[model samples]
Target chain A: MTVLEMRDVVKDYRLRNGLRSTRLRAVDEVSFTLEPGRTVALVGQSGSGKSTIAKLLMQLERPSSGEILVDGEPMPYRGARAAAYRKAVQMVFQDPFGSLNPYHTIGHHLARPVRLHHPAFSRRQVAERVLDLLRRVRLDPDFADRKPHELSGGQRQRVAIARALAPEPAILVADEPVSMLDVSIRLGVLNLLATLQREENLGVLYITHDLATARHFSDEIMVLYQGSVVEHGPADEVILNPQHEYTQLLADAAPAPERRLARHRQPTLAAREGGGQQPLG
Target chain B: METTTQGTTQGSAQSSPQGSTEAAAPSATAERRPVTRKRRLFPPMTLKLGVGLSIAGLIVLFGLIGPLVVGDPSTVRDIGLTGPGHGFLLGTTQTGQDIFAQLAYATRGSLIIGVVVGAITLLLSSFFGLVGAFVGGWVDEAFSLLTNIMLVIPGLPLVIVISSYVPNKSIWLVAAVLAITSWAGSARVLRGFTLSVRSRDYVLAARIGGEKRWRILLVEILPNLIPLLASQVVFAVIFAILGEAGLSFLGLGASGSFTWGTMLYFAQNGLSLRLGAWWWFAPPGLLIALFGAALSLINFSIDEIINPKLRSQTRAERNRWGMSREQRQAAAEVTV
Candidate 1:
């Protein structure tokens, strides 16, 4: 019942020059579905239409020609219906710093969703709910009164996750949620998302370009290259034995620890063999 | 890589209270800030704020209670052009109207018109500017066109002509004239602000979060525009009061009321300046200047608070860690 499906969605942008128009396809005949309790990773590099897919699912932008279905029903078109649908499907944006309003306190951010979803809840109930959400995100309740500027990256991302979770959304579309974070903390945020997905039975569409995290975190991986899905299957099949050439290129690009060490050693070895200052590459 | 690293550190700093955020920020900022922290009377209050509060407090005090303590401004209770006598502390006008009472009552009219016009202009400008920028395309084109059309046209001449055409004008009518003419400038500025602010990721996030347009405008957009709005109101007040005085001096003021504009009008008509009777017009003129200064100071103070680029260099920063402050001072001395 909680399946979110994209059916052959096509999105095009019309570039205009003195009334002459040309179309550029951003997402070309793309199709996928996110099922409850499963994590679907949309993997691609920048401008490969990974985020455009996320935007399309969030209904921030419309598909030029395609169908998006929520449990076999067409996505809501009008404002009221869209708002109601939003309560069931929420988003955690890429940049946590930019996504959360700076002027508001953490309490304010957490309270808004609860208040919107449960209008019948008393003020005390809403307060407790905010604390509960903060707790769920592994944040201190005292952090609620602080502004967005007072929180760390991981903490802010956690708050953002908590906000997305506040409405008890069955589907969560997180677009590059950890790419901007420090390398050290990225795993912790990914693990939190994975844990939340399992606990809530949420359909998580985790959008990212980093295939390493995608392999470790996602149940299924969909490799997107230049707006088309080049590869899609179980995470292991996609990463360990990539079927498409583009997916192979991406896999090759992701440097493993041993590969990085070998690469670093080669440069020094090359330097020893009169390759010093030989353009470093 | 640097941007992402710095962003992570800043983000952690915000979340962590006084950790890596400060550790990173201080190194970048410490050299620039030589002035060390000291005990401040009002820690948050800026210099302009204190000065503005004092002046504004006086203006309000006069507007509220000054008239109540004086006799009626209209009553011709003394001989024409008489000095302070018979309890008339500010002497009498050419027509024997009490100058003190006139100044007090005039404060009310001038303030009333200025405040109302400020409110009206701010409303119109904010609505046009924010709505246009937020919902761009044809709506923005239309708004920009209207604003540009109004801006290029001479505002005062337009106000004068429009005011002249209206028969039996009141203070509110004068305010309306000022508002209609003056809102163009603020709308243009606000449109620029709104354009930049509307693109901030939080605003987009709020929109995608299912918050309605009005709520996004009010909650997300409006708080960011407070300083701009405050500055606009300050400008609007200055123009409204000045406009009032100009129109009234031109004999377009409400006939029944004694506004500052009318007071100046009467003073000019009676040749008070030529006759060496300074009491007639100087007080209202001085009050206008005082009000202008007060609002300007408040605007200046707020600018530093809201706009980081304009913040004062001599900030009170505590030299907590080492003799870096002393070392910087020595380095500055060496440079000098």
Candidate 2:
């Protein structure tokens, strides 16, 4: 069943002059459906409005046109309805550095959400729940007492995930979550997110520019270009047999081992022994 | 504390391309003696160099047990109240009031005005700014216009006109007027800053976490604005003190009060500056400068500490044994 649906979501931002103004279309008639317990990766280059779409889903930015519905009901833009939507739809931002509040401890960051979203949880229950969340993200429970500055980049990203999950959101919009992470730790975070998605039956909208990570993390891939989806399908099919020119260019740009080794070493020698084309392998 | 000191020491040592670890190590060791010891010597700001803090402390120490050592401030003397050879330390004023006693009693008023005015300004400006920034719409437009209008009006002249009209206004009432005048500029600046911070992703995360507007403003926005807001409060206090002095100097503050400003006002009318009665004017004038400078120094020091770029650039006077900029720059380049 489709849990979240965007029907022609269009967003425009106004640019000001001294006496005149211009409207720039950030998201142009973008439409997509997110199914239950599934992952949809919105793949786009910078300026492709993928992040705008994610914000629209989270209702951080309102759509200029069209409907955003959860369970076939159009979401309201303000007051109690907006509040309800906010509780249901959680977001993980791009810059892991700026995603968490710097002044607050990790436990303060997690507890507020759990207590607000799940009021039935007692003080001890909240404490236990926060610890469980920390553990689920592969962080030490003791680390909760520490501030965001005390944690490493990977650890901060995990805390962000834990905070997002505290609300037990139906739709989790992760905007380039692992892009800011080190390549070695990126897969682990991705795997954790995937695990949480299945266990919680979350409809995850994973937005990224990295086609390779998209293939690894997402079930269905939507290739957005210049504020519109040019190509989309099952992740493997879309990535392996890219139908559009932009998708082909993106697939060619994926940082494979052979190309990385070839930049300093030789591509011809490595290509002969099969270049790092298969990301799943 | 130990770990952070250890980390900083290690970082200084590991990254020391200029070979200044010999000097930086001891200072790092000195810094690690728990922030409490450092705080004991330098209690944030006012605890160390605040003339007001010291004067207030001294006055409190003396006031309760002061009468035992000295006579009442208001007590008049007819003769032999002229010279320093007598019992009076600061000698007597033209009205036969003891200079030292009057100074101590007057401090109570000044301190009260400073605290009352400073706190009022801080709370008012922060509220106005936070609301304007967070609510943002017609509310922002209305506040922006109001603050800008208030900013353009001559503050001192307005205070003079208003205080003159409202006869028998208390020191607290004068403070309220000053507070009302001073908050406009701070509100505008804080509003701009809060607007920027409110747009950050974490703020959105907090909103999505089901935080109310007040909680988001207090918990999310206010915490980040502390370093900025703290500096602002210090500025507000200095301004309030100076403004209070200015008003009193113009005879608009507490009437016939022995405040530093009132001292200046009375001295200007009474003592001929040409006659070298610098004794009357110089001390209080110097005290005003002292209060302003002390707050300014603490604010600048805090700015330096909180700001990493500034901290890196500034060398401590006590511990000047550090690598030069060229050396540090070379070291950072190597790291990159």
Q: Which ten residues in a row have the lowest lDDT in candidate 2 chain A?
A: A272-281
How close to the true structure is residue A116 of candidate 2, measured as C-alpha lDDT?
92
Quote each prediction's TM-score: 0.85, 0.84
Model 1 residue B142 CA deviation (Å) reads: 3.6
TM-score (chain B only), all candidates: 0.80, 0.75
Tens-digit lDDT track of model 2 for B1-336:
976876787787786543575688889856765564343233355333355466545544553454455667777777323543367776665666676666555555566677777788788788888888899999989888888888999899999999999878787888898888998888888898999999987898888788888999899999788777777887887888798889988889866455667767766776626546565566567767766776776676566544645543434632567778889999999999
Top-scoring candidate (DockQ):
2
The number of the candidate with the highest lDDT is 1
Residues A1-281 of candidate 2: C-alpha lDDT, one tens digit per residue? 33788999889999998879999898888888998788999999999999889877776788889998878898877888777777778888888888788888899999999999778989999999999999889899988877787688899999999999898778899999988899999998899999999888998999999888899888999999989889979999998889899998898888677656545465565566685543321
RMSD of 2: 6.8
The Cα local distance difference test for each model comes to 0.85, 0.79
